[model samples]
Structure formats: C-alpha cells, structure tokens
Target: MDTVTHTFFGLTLYAAVKKEGWSRKEKTAFFVTAVGGSQIPDIDVISSWWDTAGRYQMWHRGLTHSVFLVPIWAALFSAISWLFWKVKGWKLYGLGVLAVLIHDTSDLFNAWGTGYLEPFSTQRITFGTIPIVDLTLWAIMLGGLLYAKLRKISRPHRVYKLVWLLMACHFIAQSAQGYALYEQHAGRYEQFALSAGFVPGQFQMIGKKNGVVEISNATAFTEPKLQVELKSQESADLDKLFAANPKAKTLYEWSPFVVLVDNEKQIGLYDPRFYRNGQSFLFEAIEKDLKQGK
Candidate 1:
C-alpha cells in the first residue's frame, strides 16, 4: 500500500475506538502510537543516504518491515508514548502492535512486495492482488465516513469496523480472481507475473514462454483482453553489461521474474510485470559498445 493509504489506516483505526470515558491525554497517546507505528516501517528509506553498494533496492522494504520487528516497533512506540504523554497502559502497546502489523501485512498484497521474513528468508513476498493506490479502499473509507455523518450514527466506531470487514472481503475476492486467471494460463507459460489494475477486480497478467512475453488484462466477469506482446532475443551477451552496471545485476537477482532485452547494441533486463506501453521504470540497461571498453 501507498503512504497515504497507510496513514488513513492509522487514522481510521484510531477513530474506530469508542470515545466514551477516554481522556484527552489517552487519545493523544493512542494517536501517536497509531500513526507512528504505521509510518515506522518505511523508515528504512533513510538508508539510501549511507548506501554505497546500490543495495537500496533490497534495503528499502527490508528488515524494518519484517514480521520479527513488529513487536520491537510496538514496544518502542509504547515507550516513547509513555515518556511523552505520561499515559501508560496496555492498550497503547496493543494498538501499537496492531498498527504495525497492519502496515506489514497490507504491503504484502501490492506488486512491489516486502521483505516480511527478512533475515530468515531473503525472498520478497508479494501477492500482487492489490494496486499500490487502490481507489476501492478510498471509496469504502470515504463512504463509511459519509454514512456516519449523514445518518448521525451514535456508534461510528462500529461503522469503521464494518468498513474494515468490507476491505478484507475486497482483498480476498481480488486474490481469488487473480489466482484463477494465473492457473488458467499456468501450464502454457514457463513464468508469469500478476499485477492488479487500478480498478477493483481487474488484473494485468504477464506470461513468458520461450522468449515471448504476453501482457494482458482480465477480470472475473469479463474475457481476457490481449494488451501487447514482445519477443525477446537471447543471443545478445549480458556478461559485459552486468559487469558495468552492478545495479542491473542486483535488480536481476531481486526480481522474481524478468524480461531480458538483448538487441546487440544494448543489453538490459526489466521486470516484465512492470512493463508498460514501451518501457518499465524498473529497467536497467548498458550499451553493448560501452561494455567492450570496460
């Protein structure tokens, strides 16, 4: 999920709490715990300032987002809240843990993935069942807020909880549909990657077989539509290119799947899942002529 969505998650969870009998100090403490925990995992981005090996790709969503770090983050946030507000309670710890857990779990659904296991496993786990910026979630949260205000609901907290439930259902449904589509084409392709479209229930599926890549879109209720196709030439040598661009080597190792581009003049690799109309942001290339001199 994106930063805005994560912030909204924190705010929504905090607001969902019943305000009855809660003092201002208690509310402020919980607020910090919620928002801080939600944003804490992304702190790894700061590592870029000190990174010299081009490992920031592997370091951004690295150990900080690990499941093993959840409790540590929660405890750290709780201690900070206690020190700042002098409001000490178990609820603060619990809310902190919940917010951190939500942040890690939600990241797993997007295409960029997360290092949830980190030190234990170097694998980048990703379901790709949800887009980074999901309009569906925004609509659900916004709708809940509007209903709560217009209906004058005495228990708005309950409405927020209901919205969470709806969000879960939405995720499950999207995953199932993507799974089905992947299965339908699995045997025919040697490798495949799935990316959720901006629209709910829509997906972009990329499958590669024998150097040919197929990019298409599908939905649970609609027929799969072919978007574009590209044939990869594997004859181009990549040793020189990889030697020149260490980041390209790292990218090749980090990605679960990739599309190799070798047209003799240049050698490059890109994540096929991110292949847009003509190029991908995740691509790294080096000129073949330059490779010879290095």
Candidate 2:
C-alpha cells in the first residue's frame, strides 16, 4: 500500500483504539512508530547493487513483508519509539506493532505487492481486488480525516466511526477481488504453465506484458514475464483474435498490450523498445549479453 495510505490508516486505527488505555501521547507514539515500521519493508531497495549478478539476491517483496516480521519489525520500531514514550513501554510497543501490521496488511491490496519473506522465500503478494488508488475508499477516508481535523465535532462522533467502517469494507472488498481472480484461473493454471508462468499463489498482480500475460513476480528484480492464454469465453469476444498471432492467438484472447511487433518472422514485440531507455546503455547491455550468447 502507499505510504500515505498506511499513515492515514495507522493514524485512524490509533485514534479508534485511543479509548482503551493509551493516552494521547501513547497514541501519537503508536502512529509515528507504525508509519516508520510500514516503510521498513522498502529498505531492501538497497539490494539493487546485488541485482547486477542475481535478481533473486534481494527480492523486493521478500521476507520483509512477512507476517512474522510484524512482531519483529513492530518490536523494533516500538523499541525505538519507547525510547521517547517515557512511561509503560509495553502499551506503546503493542499499539505500534498492531498499527504497523495493519499498514502492511493494507498494502497487500495493491498491484505492487510486497514480499513478506525476503531472507527466507522470495514471494510477492498483491490483490488487484482494489486498485492501488480506490476513489470511493479514498473519498471516505480522506473526507473523514478532513472532517475530524477540520470540523469541531467530537472525535468519538458517529461520522468518525463511519470512516473506519468504510476503510474496513474496502480492505475486505479488495481481498475478495484477489481471491476471485485466483479462483478464476485455478483450473486453467496448467494451460499457461509452459508458455510462461503463473504465480500459483494469491493476490499477486497479474498483467499483460509485451504480448504475453505476465505476473509481476518480485522474485525477479526485473519481474520476469509470464504468458497465460485466455479461454475464448474468458476473453471479450476473442473470436476476432483468431487470425492475430494464429499460433499465440489460439491461446490468447483480446489483449490490447499483446500486439505483434512487426508481424514478421519469429521476432516480434518491441514496446518501450529497448532503445527508448537510452540506446547507448541499452546497446551496451544487449551487446554484452549477445557476446555471451545469453
């Protein structure tokens, strides 16, 4: 999930739980710690230096995104936050951990999912169930925040409660969307097995890439592509695609990104074409790989 969203959700959750035993100071501490903890997952970006050799070295959504990390990361952040809490440290630590974990959970709803197990297993998770930016959820959550901070209404008012409820609904709806997509391809997983790859897991962002249905596997630094063909009915009137790539088309459906490069011999596809990112560097890399016959 977006950091901003995590922060907002964390803050709202903190506020909602304030009535328990946490004071305003403790709530504030929890919110801050959660925000920081939520960002902890991305610290793996530093591993790009290793990607030069092996893409799996420091996969993005790996162990850092794990549920197990929740306690560890939260405890880590809580310890840092505790240094400043100046009181019963456990409250801040507990609240901080829960809030941060919520932030991680919320992020699983987006396309750029995280890997909860980096040092362990390199797996990414995402549920296209809710778009990275869901307007309705945004409106309700942002509106609620605006009202809480702008309006002079009591914090415990019904309106504030509604915001939390809406956010919760969004999370559930997003999770369901992911599950639905997974089930949609459950039986067909074998069809696309050889051509490309299937995540074979839940909530990973699946997309069309360079004319092939691909799953953005964070396990690969560049996100190796996957190719999955859609059943005729699975596509939007795929009969028309019969003549497209004949061989590939037999399996593919109506995919806009799945275009034939020049419709020539065996070699097609060139979107954003390598030359677009700086021909010299691109050529150098391509040349280097070619020299090695990779």
Candidate 3:
C-alpha cells in the first residue's frame, strides 16, 4: 500500500478506539503510537541516499518491513509515548503492534511486496490482490466519516469499526477473485503472478513458460484478453551486464522472473510484471561498448 493508505489505516485504527473519559494527553499519546508505527517501516527509503551499489531496489522494502522488526518498532513507539506524554501502559504498546502489523501485512497484498520474513528468508511475499492505491478502501473510510457526522452519533468509534469490517470484506473479495483467476490460468504456464488492476475485479496475469512471457488482462466473469507476448533471451550471458550495472543484478534478484534483452547494442533485463506502454519501468540496461570500456 502507498503512504496515503497507510496513514488512513493509522487514522482508522485510532478512530476505532473507545476514548470515553480519557484525558487529552492519553488520547494524543495513542494517536502518536498509531500513526507513527504505521509510517515508520517506510524509513528504509533513506537507504537510497547511500545506495552507491544500486541495491536500493532490494533494500527499500527489505529488512525494516520484516515481521521480526515489528516488536522492536512497537517497543520504541511505546517508550517514546511514555517519555513525551508520561502515559505508560500496555495499551499503547498493543496499538503500536497493531499499527505496524497492518502496515506490513497490507503491503503483502500489493504488487510491490515486502520482505516479510527478512533474515529468515529473502522472498518478496506478494499476493497482488489489491492495488497500491485502493479507491474502494478510501471510499469506505470517507463514507464512514460522513455517516458519523451526519448521524451526529454519540459513539463514533462504532462507525470506524464498521469501516474496518467493510475494508476487510473488500480485501477478502478481491483476494478470492484473484485466486480464482490464478487457478483458472495456472495450467497454461510454468510460473505466474497476478497484478490487480486499478478497478476492482480486474487483474493482469503474467505467466512465463520456457523463455516466453505472456501478459494478459483477466477477470473472473470474462475471458482473459491477450495483451502482449515477450521473449526472454534465456541463454544470454549477463556477466558483463551485472558487472557494468549493479542495479541490473539487484533487479534480477528482486523480480520473480525477468525478460532478458541481449542484442548487438546492449544487454539488459526487466521485470515483465510491470510491463507497460511498450516498455517496462523496471528495466535496467547497459551498452555493450560501455561494458567494454570503449
């Protein structure tokens, strides 16, 4: 999920809490715990400034987003709350855990996956069942806010709780449809990935077989329409490319599969999952002459 979605998750979590008769200081402490924990995992973005080896691709959502770091982050947030607000309790720690957990888990459902297991495993766990920016979720949250305001309810936390429930249902529905589409096309390819489209109930199916990659638009209620076919140069030697452009090596490791491009002019590879507009945004290339020091 994107930054906006994560922030909203924090806000919704805060709103869902029952704060009846709570002091303003206690409320502020909880708010900080919720929102800060939600946004802290993305601190890995700073690695880019020191990324001389072009390994930012692997480091951005890497160890910081790991499940192992959740408790550490929660403890830090809890301690910070105690220091600033003088509010000390397990409730703050628990809310921090929930906020961080939501951040890490929500990322798994998108195309840009996270290193959930981290040191235990380096796999990018992605379900791709939800878009990075889910408008439906935003709508649900917005609607909840409107309903609470218009109804002038004495207890507004109930409204936010309902919002969370609706959001969960949306997630389950999207994942179910994505799974069905995956099963529907599983036999056609040796390897596959699903990228949920902007609109709900739609997906981009990327499947690779032998050295050929097929990208298609698919939905549960409709036949998958062929989008494009990409051929990977499986036999190409990437030693020079990796040596010349280290980012290419990281990209190669980060992606589940790559479409290799080796020709007279240059050698490179790109993730087919992000293919669009006649090119892939994740592509990394190096000129043959540059590699040869010409």
Candidate 4:
C-alpha cells in the first residue's frame, strides 16, 4: 500500500479503540503507538541514500519489513510510550504489534512485494490482488468517517470497526477474483503473475512461456483482452551488464520474470509485470558500445 493508505490504516486502528474511560494521556499514547507502528517499517527507504550498488530495489522493502522485526518495532514503541506517558502494559505492546503487522502484511497484496521473511528467506511474497493505491479502500474509510460525523455517534469505534470489516471483505473479494483468473490461465504459461488494475474486479495478467511473455487485461465476468506480447532474449549474455550495473542483477533476481533485451545497440532487461505505454519503468539497459569498451 502507499503512504496515504498506510496512514489511514493507522488512523482507523486508533479510531477503532474503545477508550470510553481512558485518560487523555493514555489515549494519546495509544494513538502514537498505532500510527507510528504502521509507518516504521518503511524506514528502509533511507537506504536509498547509500545505495551505490543499485540494491535499493531489494533494500527498500527488505529486512525492515520482515516479520522478525515486527516484535522489535513493537517493543520500541511500547518503551517510548512508557517513557513519555508513564503508560506501561501489554495493551500498548499488543497494539504496536498489530500496527506493524498490518503494515508488513498489507504490502504483500501489491505488485511490488516485500521481503516478509527476510533473513529466513529472500523470496518476494506478493499476491498482487490489490493496487498500490486502492480507491475502494479509501472510499470505505471515507464513508465510515462521514457516517460517524453525520450521525453524531457516541461510539465511533464501532463505526471504524465496521470500516475495517468492509475493507477486509473488499480484499477477499479482489483476491478471489484474481485467483480465479490466474487459475483459468495457469496452464498456458510456465510462470505467471497478477497485477490488480486501478479499477475493481480488473487485473493485468502476465504470463511467460518459453521466451514469450503475454500481458492481458482480465476480469472474472469477461474474457481477457490481449494487451501486448513481449519476447525475451533468453540466451542474452548479461555478464557485462551485470558487471557494470549491479542493480540490473538485483532487478533480474527480484522480479518474478523479466523480458531480456539483447540487440545490436544495447543489452538490457525489464520486468514484464510493469510493462506499460511501449516501455517499462523498471527497465535497465546498457549501450553495446559501453559493453564493448568503445
């Protein structure tokens, strides 16, 4: 999820707390715990400043977003709350854990996955059942907020809880549709990935077989519309490219599949899942003259 969505998650979590008899200080402490924990994992973004090797792709959502680090973050938040507000208990720690856990898990549903397991495993776990910026989720949250204000509800926490429930249902529905589309086309390709479109019930299905990659727009209630086909130069010798640009190697490894470009002018590779508008944003290329030391 994007930064805005994550912040909203933190806000919703805070709002869902039933603090009927809580003190002002206690409420503030819990608020910090919820919102802070939701964003702490993204601290890995700072690694980009020192990323001379182009490993930022691998490091951005790397170990910091790992499940192993969740407890550590929670403990830190809990200690901070205790130090500042004199509020110390399992409740603070537990909410912190929940907030951080939500951040890590939510990242798994997008095309740009996270290193959820980290040191234990470097696999990028992604379902691609949700877009990076989901308007549906935003709408649900906004609607909940509006309803609470208009009705002047005494227990707004209940409204937020309902918002959470609705969001979960949306996720499940999108995942189910994506899964069905994947299964329908699984046999046609050796490797495949799903990227949920910005619109609900829609997806971009990417499949690779042999050296050919097929990208299609699909939905559960409609036939998949063929978008474009990409042919990968599977036999391309990438030794020079990898040697000159280590990020190219990282990109190759981090992506589920890549379309290798080997031609007279240049040698490069790009992730097919992000292909768009006759090019891919994730493309990495090097001139053949550079490769030949010209």
**TM-score computed on alpha carbons, candidate 3:** 0.97
Model 2 lDDT tens row, 108-153: 6554455554446445554445545456666777788778778766
Q: Which residues of candidate 1, in runs, are more than 4 Å off?
A: 290-294
TM-score for each prediction? 0.94, 0.58, 0.97, 0.97
How accurate locally, in lDDT, is each candidate? Answer: 0.87, 0.49, 0.93, 0.94
Report model 4's TM-score to 2 decimal places.
Answer: 0.97
lDDT of 4 by residue, 136-240 (tens): 999999999999999999999999999999999999999999889888987899999999999999999999999999999999889989999999999888898
Least accurate stretch of 10 residues (summed lDDT) in model 3?
Answer: 285-294
Give me the runs in candidate 3 sitting further than 4 Å from their true place. 290-294
lDDT of 3 by residue, 167-237 (tens): 99999999999999988897899889999998999999999999999999999889999999999998877
**Model 1 Cα lDDT, one tens digit per residue, 1-294:** 889999988988887878788888888988998888998999998999998777888988889999999999999988887798888778889899999999999999898989999899989998889999999999999999999999999999999999989989999999998888877876778887789999888898888899888888887677779898878766646677677887888787788777788775678888878888798899888876665653
* Candidate 4: clashing residue pairs, number: 0
lDDT of 1: 0.87
Where does candidate 4 stray beyond 4 Å? 290-294
In model 2, the number of clashes is: 13
Q: What's each prediction's clash count?
A: 0, 13, 0, 0
Q: For model 1, what is the error of residue 41's alpha carbon versus the real structure, in angstroms, after optimal superposition?
A: 0.7
Worst 10 residues of 4 by lDDT: 285-294
